[model samples]
Target: NRLLLDLETDLFATCCYVDVDMEEGSAWYVRAGHLPPVLRHPDGRTEVPESEPGPPLGVIRQTDFPMSPLRLQPGTILALTTDGLVESVEVDIEDGLNRLAAGLAGSDPSHLGLVADELLTEANRSDDVALLLMRFDGMDVLPSRESWTVWRVPEAVRHARRYTRRALRSWGVADHTDAALLIVSELVTNALVHTDGQVRLDLTLIHRRLRIAVADNSPRTPIKPTNIGWEATGGRGILLVEAMSDTWGTVPVSGGKQVWSELSLD
Candidate 1:
C-alpha cells in the first residue's frame, strides 16, 4: 500500500509510505489532497485513475480516508508523485497527464531514478518534487511486427518518416501518416540539436494510431517556452508537438532518452 499526504498551508510538505502485501502484488493505497498515481503496462499503455482522497492530513481531523486497492500484474508500473513534479500553471493538466503517460511507456525501469529526475527537471516551477515508481516483473511481451530499419544523419528522419507512414497504414491509420512524419521530424531535430550520437527511430502501429519514438544519447527533454510576448519567436518546438500530436513525452534511458509522440489515424 502507498500512502501520500500533501499539506498546502504555510508549511508545504509531502509525505509518502509504501506497504506491500506478500500474498499478492496488490496494494491498499490512500491519497490526501495529492495527485493520484499513474499505472503503466509493459506494452506501453498508461493511465491515471480517479483517486478518492480525503482532505489533506493535519488540515482536518477525523477524516475518513478511503483505501484503494491496486493489483500489480507482471510488467505493471505504478507511479506516484506530487503536483510540484508535473504541474504547470500554464499547461493543462490533461496535456500534462498525456505526456506523463507517454514518458512512462518509453522509460526504462532500471533507471527509474533518472526518469523521475528528468520529469521534475522538465516541469519544475520552484516547488519541491517527489516521485515513487514501482514495477512488476514476469509479464508476457506484446507481439509486434518484426520489421525494422536503420538510418544515419539526415537520412534517419526521412527514412523513419516513410517507415512510419507504412506502419500506420498497416494499422489502418493511413490518415495519421502526415502527423507521424512531422512528429518524427521534430524529435529527430531535437536529437540532432543536442547531440551527434547515433539516433534510432522506432515506429509502432497499434490499434488505430502510430507511436513514433526517437531515441538518442542525449539527456535533455523538451520544455515549453516561458518567455511569452508579442515578439517571442523561439521555444515552440515542444508546443507544436504537443498541440499537433495526439500525445507525447520523454523517457530517460541508461545513457540517453526516448522522446515519443502519438498520432491517431482518424
Candidate 2:
C-alpha cells in the first residue's frame, strides 16, 4: 500500500509498481483504496480485478483492505498506476487511460521495464508517476489463469473512437457501446493538446460492470472549466460522465496518480 498527502493535493504525487510471487497456484493481495491494477492476458483480454479497496493511505488509522486471489498463469501482465499518471488539465481522466492501454498492447514483454518507464513518458507530464508491469510465464497450460493485452498512444478523437470500440468489442462488451465510445473520444482530445500525453486508459468488465480508468502522468486533476466562454465546448466531458456513471474518483499511484470511473449495466 502507498500513502499520499491529500491536503497538499497540489504539491506531490506518490506512485508504485510491485510484484510478489506466492508459492501456491492462487495468491491473495490487498488494496486500501489504491489505484486498482489492470489485468492483461496473452489472449488479449483486459480487466480490473474485483476487490475491496479500503481507503487511501494515511487518511485513517487502518483500513480493512479486501484480499483477492489472482489466478496466475503464464504470460499474465498486470499494470498498476498512480493518480499523477491520469487526471489532468487537458484530457478527461478516462480518455487518458484509453491511450495508455493502446500503448501497452504494442509493448513487448522483454521490455517490461521499458514499458513501465515509457508509460510515464507517454503521459508527457512532470508529475511523479510509477507503474508496475507483472508477467506470469507458462499460462497456456495453467487452468483459470489467463492472459491479456495492453496498448497506449497519443492521437486525436478520431483515433480514440476507432480503438475504444474495438477494445470494448474485443472484450465482448456491447451493451453501453455508444456511451463508452463517446467518453473515450472526449478524453483523447483533451490529452493530445492540453497535457503531456498525460493520460492513461484501461478497459475491463467485471461482475457485469464496465470499468474505465485513465491515469495521466500529471498531478493536476480536472476542474470544472469555469470561464463563461468555456461553458459550451469545455468541461462537457466531465459533466457527461458524471451524469452517465455510477461513481468515480482519483488515487495516488507511486510517483504521480490515477482517476477511475465505472458504469453499471442495465
Tell me the number of clashing residue pairs for each predicted model: 1, 50
**How large an RMSD does model 2 have?**
19.5
True lDDT of residue 28, candidate 2: 63
Measured by lDDT, the strongest candidate is 1
Candidate 1 pairs with clashing backbones: 1-19
Query: Which stretches in model 2 have alpha-carbon errors above 4 Å?
Result: 1-155, 225-232
Per-residue lDDT over 65-151 for candidate 1, one digit per residue giving the tens place of the 0 to 100 score:
778777776778888776666667766666777777778888876677887776666666676666778776742433234244345
The deviation in Å at residue 21 for candidate 1 is: 22
Q: Ten consecutive residues with minimal summed lDDT in candidate 1? A: 1-10
Q: Candidate 1 regions off by >4 Å?
A: 1-150, 228-234
- For candidate 1, give the lDDT: 0.69
